[model samples]
Target chain A: MQVCKKCLLNDNMPSVRINEDGLCNLCSTQYESRGIVNNNEEEISSLIKANREEKYQIILAYSGGKDSTYSLKMIKERYDASILAVTFDNGFLSDTCLKNIRTVTDNLDVDSIIIKYPAKKIIRAFKYIEDGKFFPRQSMERASAICNMCIMLIKNLIYYEAIIRRIPIICFGWTPGQVMTSKPLIKLNYTMVLKGFENIKNIITSRFGARYEKYFLDDAFMRENEANMPYLYYPFVKNNYKEDSVIEEIKEIGWIPPQNTDGNSSNCLLNSYANQCHVSKFGYHPYAFEISNLIREGYLTREEGLTKIGNVANPCSYKMICEQFEKITG
Target chain B: MNIQAVNEKLKEFFENNFLYGESFDDINGDESLIDKGYVDSIGIISLVAFIENAIGIKVYDSEIVPENFDSINSIYAYLKKKMNTQDKAV
Candidate 1:
């Protein structure tokens, strides 16, 4: 268990570099060279001003997950924007997560909405996902591909909601580990949407079938809505902190754990299985890249980060996930 | 470029970038690169860029679609089709 000297990432993270001075590469290159120190209140003020100028009635993509929950907290307490916290309500939200969602939002007074996808379709998709029926195992394996689609469908639905509401910004709590940020945020342009949709089509068709092209594809609409709606991140700063300390600080703002879970998960029960599947298949989780980046940034120690991943092997949680799979199929 | 030259270029480009060790003899144009696990999302972006650069024909932002760029063969056909239409317009 090794921790980076600077950032919030641990050694279990992949694709990290520690310089001779033990500085994380991300912090050294992106932060120091760009000179975008988090303490520069002027930049924060400008970011807030730019966000306000967009006339953004934000639709925060909430999942009762920890990151999203924390993101919502930041929106209200920090930015003070007009934010609507919306969850996809994927038919399997733990009662604990639902409760925490209520707790956090009520405390912050952010408007909340939960839209449920058709349960049977979600189940069928996950069944195939867990059963490993998808093809072209290059981009994703069975478990991850299914999870990615679940998130993708939710993202599209959120976009539609944004269009109807005339909301410009669709804020997601995606940290760098989950996504790559060539630009911190940019408006969803037509070309980007077309390219993204095309890539997604290849992913689905190769794995599911050509029949899904009509159902899953949405190039036409995304292209039509191509306007400048920048996706922003706050965690791009504050990469240097211990997990417990960060969680403790956020808890002060009324963020609490969902019921029936431990530190490894703050939202979904299925995550442990997802992490396990990734580790078993690729010898690491897909999340390894970002975590490694965080470590390289000197935000976390390798020891602490490895501890977080080590918790991915809780037997009770693993059994519960397996049991749920059986119950759904039976 | 002649059709044969276009096909040869695609084969060479894929071998160099995809590095899958599969030769032109192994892959037919119509077979789905995605379906056969020969390419992934990153590969799709790279291939689209490669086609644009090599053929000197721009794939308009709108023309990006699964049907148009599903495989190396399909991509070649797409470029050829677009080239013909452009020539007619000219």
Candidate 2:
């Protein structure tokens, strides 16, 4: 339970070493001196501006969360870019998030697409992860069970939509902590590495049948046309926007807080359950590194990050998650 | 650079950076670092960075495939080939 003095990382966190000064190795290691650039608003704005003249300028992977809602609003109002917002309904969305999605997109006057996976499919995927049949064991040190699979599916669908529509920019609401430090605007060629998930795809195909391939891998299209892929952009990661201000700005666009989700998440009901499972099995919160990154970058305070991740799952949500898991596994 | 020097350098980099200063003796040079739970996707990224900086070679997106990066032996072989190609071009 011993936490880092400088960041929210605890002693239980994998790959962390606490020094005599009570600072985690990540804090003491002079990561900034490694030559990774911090948030550069000018570079991000220029990238957005350069893409603005293109047709269907941005395809935002919108999750109806506060960060994405703010991103959607920013793309429309700030850059005046034509945007297509796509939401992947993973069968665990809060009602408020759904309402927020409809209200915000309607207000923004942007085209929106919702790709809803069947509840059974999502449950089955989770079951595989839960049974340790999916994902690399080392990955558990970084990501949650639901997140590893869910993000893969979302990214694939987004890439597919962007390629088909010839959208030049694929914007995500990823924070600085979520992305590699070298760049915020990644070339499409590099983003196509998701296609290399051969082991995960094989597992899904064997366990859940080949139907999962449609969602997880767009092999035919990717093979024939991956060269024509769009650039991946992370606006939130590049700009120094305060979280409170982002919430407030999105509130003007009809975004509301959900009652069912954990403090760290605003859209998905499954996040708390996922956090619970991650902590139970791995002895650390899956989001600890992400939250710690936020703290290190001064985006969030150490105490706030700790409080946000600590004991996020409630009994009611836990019961609901168990029931859903049972129905899907059966 | 000689293969022995390159191999020694790679071992040092992986041990110092990825393994958190742990000795590389426990890991096999030919075994899959990923399958052995020694590296993940993020670890691959860091390893790529280390190669570019420490080995003085640039890894392209196409070279990120498992054939080139799944194991210490694979990485050393890929580096040797790339270096030879660079030398020939010069």
Candidate 3:
């Protein structure tokens, strides 16, 4: 298969068109707009100062991963936003992740909320998606079905907290590749949002027995926050990430890389399982595009990017996936 | 230019940039991009930006609903109306 000369993306990936010059469609399109942009420091500080009336200015979706750990450190040290770190413990999180979470939050003196829904609840959602694609083809190319569901769940839960606490910003530490946008904040069109979220909510309603459908957001939540929609922030997108620098910098905050995860992940074991399913189903890694983008934008070396996607997922994660989803197989 | 030309251009952009399937000819212009899984949450945002940059019609947040932006045909119709209004105002 032909691969892009500029980045590591190959023709095997869906929606990829490799040019005669040996550049992939994604690389060609981004070539003109590629530049380093770490320009949101002032904006974040101003928002935090202005929104002091709210208990917390930002509710950062902390995944206890290296990227997020770096983001947490930057927010506290660089921007110094009044922040509350929130994590949804998607049952497959490494034990090391929990330790990192506790140590980092305690050291930073930031309050935190760690929500662990019953594993049965998350497993049903996983099984439901096994039957069909639950997201757009583009989104599916970016991440696995299981990872998509987990991210949606985390966003919904963090958004809920932001609305309740009157926080002005809901933050995530998405890398430039993961974010796919250079914008500092994501302006969510409500109609577009509901359209995106409706299916995930339905998955939850069906699996959680419809009785607790209220667990998902309803019109009441929308009505209450109409005038004050919390701004969805991707702070990490503004920073030009160098992966090694990020890992080394975040280590001072007690963040340790977990040995249990596959090469693609630092915190969640399910990520390995998800990558396995994605490759088997799609013929290429789910992160093929994102990793290529990282290489294109100089966040990682091509060799480093290749190594990240080359290694197979953790074997133990396959066993964990079987144990979790077997509950719903009947 | 006419709405047909505008539509052809939009289709070309999506085909060259984002479409995962074989050809735009197979897609019904009236089909909802969101409902059909052609575009997701972030994809919709990118679409709006493309519309603004391509046609100079700035879409506001309230106008991002299904009626105007759900399908390629709907986007065409909205563009026609908007361009007509802009011409009249001028």
List where candidate 3 sits over 4 angstroms from the true fold. Answer: A34-43, A203-208, A327-330, B1-9, B48-68, B74-90
Q: True contacts preserved, each candidate?
A: 0.14, 0.12, 0.40
- Sorted on DockQ, best first, the list reads 3, 2, 1
Interface RMSD of each: 9.9, 5.3, 4.8
**Where is model 2 more than 4 Å wrong at Cα?**
A33-55, A131-133, A188-196, B1-22, B29-38, B42-90
Which parts of model 1 are misplaced by more than 4 Å?
Answer: A1-56, A130-143, A197-217, A227-242, A259-264, B1-90
What DockQ number belongs to candidate 1? 0.09
- The DockQ scores of all candidates, in the order shown, are 0.09, 0.21, 0.34
TM-scores of chain A across candidates? 0.73, 0.90, 0.92
Screening candidate 3 with a backbone cut-off below 3 angstroms (N, C-alpha, C), the clashing residue pairs are: none
TM-score between model 3 and native? 0.87
Cα lDDT of model 1 by residue, A117-196, tens digit: 56655665566654333534434421255456566667666766776566655677765444433223334344444444
| CAPRI class of candidate 3 | acceptable
Candidates sorted on lDDT, descending = 3, 2, 1
